[model samples]
Target: MKILLSTLAFISLAVLLGLLTGGRLSWLVRNTTALRLAWLAPLALIFQWVFFELPGMDRHDLVFAGHLLTYALILPFIWANRRMPGMPVLAAGLGLNLLVILLNGGMPVDPGLLRAIGRVGVYQDLASRGWSGNAVALTDRTLLPFLGDWLVLPEPFPARGPYSVGDLLIYAGGFWLLAGLTRRPAETEAPLKPA
Candidate 1:
């Protein structure tokens, strides 16, 4: 939630910057129709919620299996939109995240960082209770720890916990994407002559 909100905030800031520079938001909206496989984004979010965040779900392994499925669904959205600004960066971030998650059994969270942010309890519970979800505690045993949520947001940011490199990439990509789109002129449909 915090990550998504932070991403939104960054994108909003980028759009505002665009406007200040004489860029139009309408262009961004209009050009977004070129975003193929867009529907997969929402579906991916739903899968994330259902498989990772839901309560009372059974079979941790099954839920764990679903994590890969979720990423699989979202990959198409990224691939289809690769030509857009910020997409390649976003793809890299997503790839890093997916690789780390797959390697670590889920997205690895540093327990210490979680404590620093005062949000360790739920993750600890999820880890210890055999509850299925995306997020494995960062440990000496954790593979590719750097790819995990290692970038900590200090004071003033909504989330204090460590966010991933991929998270930063995602934020940057989204901001650049919006800003770039805003800089483009909106296409005006040609007026039809009396045919």
Candidate 2:
């Protein structure tokens, strides 16, 4: 929930920055018209929400599979929009996140990092739950620990919590994408055709 809120906050900032830079909302809409397979992103989110939020669904493997499937569903959308401004960066972020998640079988959140961020309740929950949603408790056994959720934003800040490097990249790319929409491209690509 915190992660989602943080993402939303970043998105809001992106929109504000865009408007402040004279980027019209209509331009964003027009720019998005070139996006293909965009619905898949939302579908991926729905898939995760359904599986991760299911009551009595404590099976780790199932949740893990659902998490992977969510990525699978999103990959096509990203690929389809690869040419869009800031998309390559977003893809890089997505790739890093997917790589870490694949290696660890889920996103890992370090308890110590959580405590440092003053999210001790989350750390305690992870300790009791073994895994929460798509995040597994970070352990020494965790592969690519550096890529895990250890980056912290302490209190007295909105959207304060642990964030991965990939998360930072994702937010940055999102900001660029939204802000970039202010500038009209030289030429628009044709809509993708059935292959």
Judging by lDDT against the true structure, name the best candidate.
2
For candidate 2, give the lDDT.
0.78
**How far does residue 139 in candidate 2 sit from its true spot (Å)?**
2.0
In candidate 1, what are the lDDT values of residues 1-195, reduced to their tens digit?
Answer: 886896578778999986787778676665655567778988988898888667775666777788888889989888767767778888888888988988878788766666667776655664576232566778788898989876777788886657799877876877777776666633222211111
- Candidate 1 Cα errors over 4 Å, as ranges: 1-7, 126-132, 185-195
| Winner by TM-score | 2
Model 1 residue 28 lDDT score: 63
TM-score of each: 0.82, 0.84
Candidate 2 segments exceeding 4 Å error: 1-6, 116-121, 187-195
State candidate 2's TM-score.
0.84
> What is the alpha-carbon lDDT of model 1 when measured against the actual structure?
0.72
Residue 172, candidate 2: how far off, in angstroms? 0.9
lDDT of each: 0.72, 0.78
